[model samples]
Target: MTENGVPILQLSGVSKSFGAVQALTKVDFEACAGEVMALVGDNGAGKSTLIKGIAGIYRFDEGEVLFDGQPVHIHSPRDAAQLGIEIVYQDLALADNLDVVANMFLGREVLQRPFRLDEAAMEESALKTLDSLSVTTVRSVRQAVAELSGGQRQAIAVAKAVMWNSRLVILDEPTAALGVAQTRQVLDLVRRLADKGLAVVIISHNLHDIFEVADRITVLRLGQRVNLYKTAETNQQEVVHAITAGKLEHVPGMASL
Candidate 1:
């Protein structure tokens, strides 16, 4: 934890290498509850590698990962899930043929008994989760994922993460390929997630959206963390400089730049 307090998630001196290729250098990162932390960088900046490490897809060569001020080891996706960490990639990983409820409970369905699926309970839970996110665009939870719009599909993916009581949700390029209106929808959903007291980390290239929703910005250059900036204290120019030059005009706070 920094001087401020313990964050929901924290990474210190984390590194990952592939053979002779260094995918990431010693990196320090953190995300606190009730805030949107934007991870921004140029292509090949190790953003994917870093989140993969947090998701348990890749183990860091060296570092400490803390969850709620407690050190923990995340060795696989299941491990991350059990620790209340969920990542929503750009593809969403939804089954087109399945309805919202079915997709939400895809692998982790509630069972009525030893041999029965609890359809009613699952549906009720799904509806409640969606309602908590204020997702009302979809006419019905029974609608196929293929029938839902882009923003609605993204919302469903997020609802799935929150439904499982995930403490931290990392979104990778969530607004990519979305139209203006759809982008607005997803951005609002991101804000709601933080408002609901979840630590949210978003990886995106759009500075406009970053400035709009992010409470803090963490800029990564190459494989190293350049700087962290509080959204209220920094501007796009400073962030762009950090992304390209790997330097910060000024460090904002313990929690940000």
Candidate 2:
């Protein structure tokens, strides 16, 4: 939470459905500045639906979205971006043919007079951003993204998200497919993002990784928010139980489990 106790992003009574199949039902979620909020759930638990809604890929059927305590409607990806919201999906969305500097400034490149690409300025800004985030594994900003390791690629994706002065960053499965050292590198960077005062929402199924970097955990079960836990106060067992068998009495049309 911020000084006034308002989360950087908040959703109240959010619901979504597809042809009578409820994906999210009156769910609420919030992410505070300078904190890592982990969204954990099993497959079909509505985690993706919630995040996509936040990113404006799917509009909520019902709910009010608040950003910095002010109401806002995000109708498209561009709308979300303009509101300082950035989403780095699991794919990383980087062009393998492009170099680090080119990927960082993709679609938002700087231009000099006569529409010339401001290569020097873009490179300088990219280097500064990466350095500020302590991403030193990248050998050269001029090297093609295809030549980087999994961890290095993930770092670049994250760096791209925050470099645009984004206030809320949502990462989907950031460490999904990586070795131990690479996972550690990505997790450390995730923590550093929160430490730098950005509202971070990380979606991952790995409890170990979530526990390592999250300040709070939001568990979704069967399209409903079943539990909220302070990472320090709850154990992995408890969280797993919540995900698999949390109370679902409030969710209509769901069978008792």
Candidate 3:
């Protein structure tokens, strides 16, 4: 547990390469249960590469991944899922024509004893999951995705990730495109995810949203982890400096890279 309790996910000296390009260089990261870790960086800062490695889309060439304080290998999305990690990409990847219930159980649908698609069970489970997340924006679980607002769709995407008992949920730019009210609703859901004792990682460029929902902030620059900070100990300026310059003057008791 490294003294701070066992982290749900931890990456140590993690590096990934694509042919001749070094996408990540000795990156160290950790996320704990019930805490929101915000990953912030500029364009081409290797944020996406880091997330891909964790998602099992791109294997890290060097380093180790520890889940619940035990070393594990993740080579595919299924492997990550089996470890109780779920990621919601920025695009959301929901089928517009499908209803909220159908989208929630798209690939992992439940079946009854007779091998028939269990519509009642799936709908009930979907509604229950949404309720657990305190997602009440959408009027009904049977509402079509195409008919729901952007915030509602984002909520459903998050709900789907959490529905499978996922311990760690990573959201990529969840509130990038939405009105003020919609953004607020999505941020509220993000906080509720942590409140339910699930580890949450958010990749976003919005400092405002990060300040609003994150408990800790991890900054990446030039394919490397610059610094990690407690949200309360650092302000927007310090975070911005870490993102642009990769370092800042050491705070009183905070770790220095």
Index of the highest-lDDT prediction: 2
Between the candidate structures 1 and 3, which one is better when assessed by lDDT? 1
User: Of the candidates numbered 1 and 2, which has the greater lDDT value?
Assistant: 2
- lDDT, candidate 2, 1-257, per-residue tens: 33333499999999888876888888999999999999999899999999999998999988899999999999999999999999999999999999999999999999987789999999999999999999999999999999999999999999999999999999999999889999999999998998888999999999999999998999999999999999999999999999999998475544223
Q: Superposing every Cα of model 3 onto the true structure, what RMSD results?
A: 4.8
TM-score of each: 0.94, 0.96, 0.93
lDDT of each: 0.89, 0.93, 0.89
TM-score of candidate 2 versus the correct structure, residues matched by position: 0.96
Error of 3 at 185 (Å): 0.7
- lDDT accuracy of residue 171 in candidate 3: 98
Runs in model 2 deviating more than 4 A are 1-6, 252-257
Ten residues in sequence with the least summed lDDT for candidate 3: 248-257
lDDT of 3 by residue, 1-257 (tens): 12343489999988776666666778899989989999999987789999888989889988999999999999999999999999999999999999999999999889887678999999998888988888888998888999999999999999999999999999999999888999999999999998888999999999999999998999988778889988888999998998998752223122223
Please list all clashing residue pairs in model 1, or write none if there are none.
228-257, 229-257, 251-257, 252-257
Ranking by TM-score: 2, 1, 3
**What's the true lDDT of residue 235 in model 2?**
100
- Candidate number with greatest TM-score: 2
lDDT of 2 at 110: 97
Alpha-carbon shift of residue 186 in model 1 (angstroms): 0.9
